[model samples]
Target: MIRHDTPSLMLLWSLLALSQAASAAPDTELTPIEVTASPIPSVAPLEGQDYSASRVDADGLAVFGGPAQANPYRALDLMPSVNLTGVDAYGLSVDQNAMRVRGIAASTYSNLAVTVNGTPSSVSAGRGGVGNLFDMENLESVTLWRGAQPADVGLGMGNLAGSLDLAIKGPTEEAGARLRTSVGGDGFHKLFGRIDTGTFNGGSSLFVSGSTSESDKWRGEGGQSRDTFNAGFAQTFGERGSLEIYAAHNRFHRDEYRPLTYAQSRDLDRYADLDYNADLTGVATTDADYYAYNSQHFDETNLLARFSWALTDDIQIRFSPYWLSNEGERRVGKTDKVMVIDIDQEQYGATAELVAELADQTLTLGYWTQRLSSMPPPMSQKVYAIDKQGGLVFSKWGILADMGDRAYESPYLQLSGERGRWRYGIGLRYLSFRIPGITSYDGSGLPNMSHDSALSMNPAVVAALSTDAVTLDEWLPTLSSRFELTPALDLKGAYGRSVGNPWMGPLYSVYMKNRKAFQKAGIPLQQLWDDLALETSDTIELGLEWRHGSLVLTPTLYYSDLSDKQVTAYDPAVGVSYLQSGVDAKAYGAELEASWGLDRHWTLIGSLSWNRNRLDDDIRAGSAAVLETSGNQVPDAPEWLAKLGAEFRYGNWNLTPIARYVGRRYGDALNQESVDDYATVDLNAVYRLGKVAGMQSLEIGMSVVNLFDADYISTIDVGQDDARPESIDYYPGAPRTLALSLSANF
Candidate 1:
């Protein structure tokens, strides 16, 4: 049968014909592109590896490399089941356009807990923010959890759905090394490679990667660019254990775009240059005087040691200890704009976990500890950098010594038993926090003299603690059960209660804390107000999965009753932005997913979800606005979401095209202004040719996002007096984008 992805099929046929025409002169081997790279010819699950759920490597569709986005998570922005929220200015930098399954995030971007081969994507930021997305070039396989969580995993802040894991290739997977280089659309270039070799009793792997890229900011007033470096290694130690170590560094040496007022967008080009305009409206057409800004510069290193002891054939135990260190600095343009310079930061921490299983039951325990410190120069020495460039330059002025140390231990006791076809388990977790204060960054410069202003201030935090230090916490308990009603039908349910301790980031505003320091110097102290309310919630999930001949389906229903919800508030009196205690809230939703094997050459998959959540009490932050829309649909939460796609394979050919839909969402929780819904389409393909051509593989693919140009708003900031809901200004989604890429293997 003919395929809907005719273009991909055509490419596949052409490639096969080309290979037939080329005659190879006999001595060297030619590699195929689609063949996966792995050195170990024999495979077995490594003992003590905490591998669990696997995620679909749906991101295999990206085509663009370098200058254009060429990574997996970045390419899946329009994939089905994903509600990537941000659309307007600095979408990548904002946390709103996050990834989740059934509306449940992995807590911070890295916390989602899917273990493939045994590593989880770790994010340096918290749930309220985003950092550099994972680099896809280093991955061997990517898989998302189908929903049944493993026995050894736990979630404290963001685990409700499942997790996604990636299994990177080991040196044993390949006997030699491979390297690639690319240059592209944005002023971008990158070089990366991997090498593997086997030695006495085991194997070793080494990898090095680096890239630099930048684009003229859409607003034309700044440069949206970046540079990055990552390197790592993994090795085995006889039969006793295996160890892996890695280090990564990223620098967002780009320009900062000040969020604009509604009025600004109405007069300037979407992302234009402002310097050419005779009038200054704080808006650029396509080109303008841009600032040299630096927000996050990080140096992170990690080490993992896995050990196991076999007590007997039926019983065994394993322990894992890990360590991590993070150091970064932020600097806004000392030129055209006054920016926040992150000149002070150095953080370190470690975590450990142990697992044991006897018969059908399993027991596990985990503990985590952390420390953070940052010291900034005094403000009197840094106000000149903010006026002309409007940079977040104030970041260089605050200091914090939050002898930050937080520790938590959760132990799970699981019992496996069947009663009339029912299997169940009970779990109890003891969690706590002792995080000291966190530093804040006030983008807008502050007046050295006493003055009343509305702004978000980075507060200086100089305190320390140990054991569950960030959020207020107590012990938590949970229960889960499942019933196998029939061979093809199973029902599972869980109910639990958890709390979120206020992360140090929201606990102290450096600007507010420094007010006392300023007042001591004859300056007025900003009036300060902080909310320290821990969120306590009850959650229940009921789900069912059914499998028939060629089809598998699953449906899950969830409800959460919450109190003291946390949300952002900008204070005008002290010019600070802080997360304050909020009124009660309720969230209820349901998710449905299905995958069908139409035939050996084709398969169909789809997912849909609906949500209803709102605040029960009023909430307000800063001079931004009063959030009095009680019972209003939550901001950034859509009422309906759906995505459908199909995959087809013929010989060495593969083709996939997907469609996704997002429902209308309230732009603001307190206002009637709204963001319209949108639909996007994408396509991708890959082919392999090694069986007849020796040991070589080649892969070429392309994808088009926002296939149809759709005008939609990602975010809207209209609270300032000069801006209002009635304004036509908005942050626009991207125009149609096309990407292509090629890869070869030996």
Candidate 2:
């Protein structure tokens, strides 16, 4: 009999007490960690090569043993608490990216709230919402929190489900390098390399990794492909001191729909059956008949440093400085009717923290400050367009504007630790935002003609804010607790009044558009671009965790009450959408995750998360705020998401299979029409042969995706057709895919 007694569970009673100590640092994602598993693996490389290289080696991971599919998000979406916004297994979209979590995405561009070795990724295209989160070449281990979370998250607004944390591989042990290549269907090809050296004394050697990938689109007129480059290096100064550096550059190009219709999607998909999808795309994209086209070029760079020193056994100090920069430009064909952006963000902070273990309790304290600033684009050009048949006419309207410059400072504190059977945490935070004139535009470049998208042609679109308040300021408080119930079980709970200032992304502000654009006259002019606002919410979560040998289970329940819930809506007249109206809403959910470590030869893991959110009221028409979600489930939020998988290893052979499930959702919030539910099963296998007499280490693997060849819609959204007839829109999934790769280590 297992007695759920306090004394019997004391050792397993790990408590996290909250603190307001200036010594605090940002909390990371909750990646279900199996301490019993082998420590993160690392290896060395050939001499004269860039050492300090390590790989999570997604290639060899049993999950990807099969071929690549449309779901580029892949294992990233299967991790605990992880969810996707625009991802559906084998969906219509080839990119199959664009994501959100909890209930919202980090920004419109789908930038995830990511921390690479404790450094936040830059989301500003040019001082605001503009890019993606990762380059497979630079990724180490991305730990996903998947939903309800701790405070100190979200550079701006966030989702209701979960979060993800990415740890770019750094110097671990030995010194080594690697080079690999692979080619697959649809013109898919990948090449990459890496090297790393273990930590040196209090300091470690450096490491670097980079890769490039390109693939042809399987549908539409013009296909698409992309290239990315990444590099990372890190080392420590003393036992408590360290330095990490990283940088990335990406260039992307894609053809427009070439007038492809929603109905024709299935026709293009049919090409997959004949093994000629990519070929069809390549043929349709010739210069003679090419009509519409879009291509975007983006560049990003980042740098960070963290240093800590132990003044005493119970006290320590830490400091960090980070800088990021990004710039992007987009154009349709040869027209200068382009969108340009440039952003540079930086942060510097210092902290003093104490961890004192007393006879009866442990105490913690800390404090810190930070500052952020943004700058709009530089000199720009407005071009006019004239088509032979006037089919798709474009012209520069006039007066380009820029979102004004602004910056802010924040101070924070916290206290947490364990005292006997009780562990508690409490903290406070405050921020200030300053913007003299949030919207600034030049009244130049007006073409002498009329166009529907005039305002959009201005190239420089700024958020509309008419506030005399030089600074937006706010304060917040939080609390948390945990208790050990039995040696094999523990209970934890947390509540906090957390507030987020809008980011330069999905979060919007109300604005007016030009008549003849997408709106009617007399519409309010509340330009909705990303803005700064205070979002306060109370969150509570309870968890029951258990561990037996290598078997582990964690069941969690949570609720969130949001005040001024920032929702995004679109406008027509101004040709814009903004984060304007917010209402009261509550989100509650439960998640169960378990992994049974049967034996070295057999093990199983599975997880499921469910959430329900209710809006307090409905949104009005054309404020560009169309939730259309009256009395229906929230868009992009599914009710139930689950996954299960099992793996068995024998001698040098391994076999595994996985199943994924996604519940149905309404095409619109009103729930008038519903999308059917879907599920997928995949298979994988790997055989590791001992090194050849003259060879070091070598491996080969095979993977199959969407083994069943099922057709399913992963996402559906509110859309309107000609005459503005309200309708739902959906993105199709990719067809089944297969991949095989061979690798060696020397």
TM-score of each: 0.72, 0.73
What is the total number of backbone clashes in candidate 1? 76
Please report, as a residue range, the 10-residue window in candidate 2 with the lowest summed lDDT.
Answer: 44-53
Query: How far out, in Å, is residue 85 in model 1?
Result: 3.4
Leading candidate by TM-score? 2
Would you give me the overall lDDT of model 1?
0.46
**lDDT (Cα atoms) of all candidates against the true structure:** 0.46, 0.46
How accurate locally is residue 451 in candidate 1, as Cα lDDT from 0 to 100? 15
Model 2 per-residue lDDT at 129: 26
The RMSD of every model to the true structure, in order and in angstroms, is: 9.5, 13.1
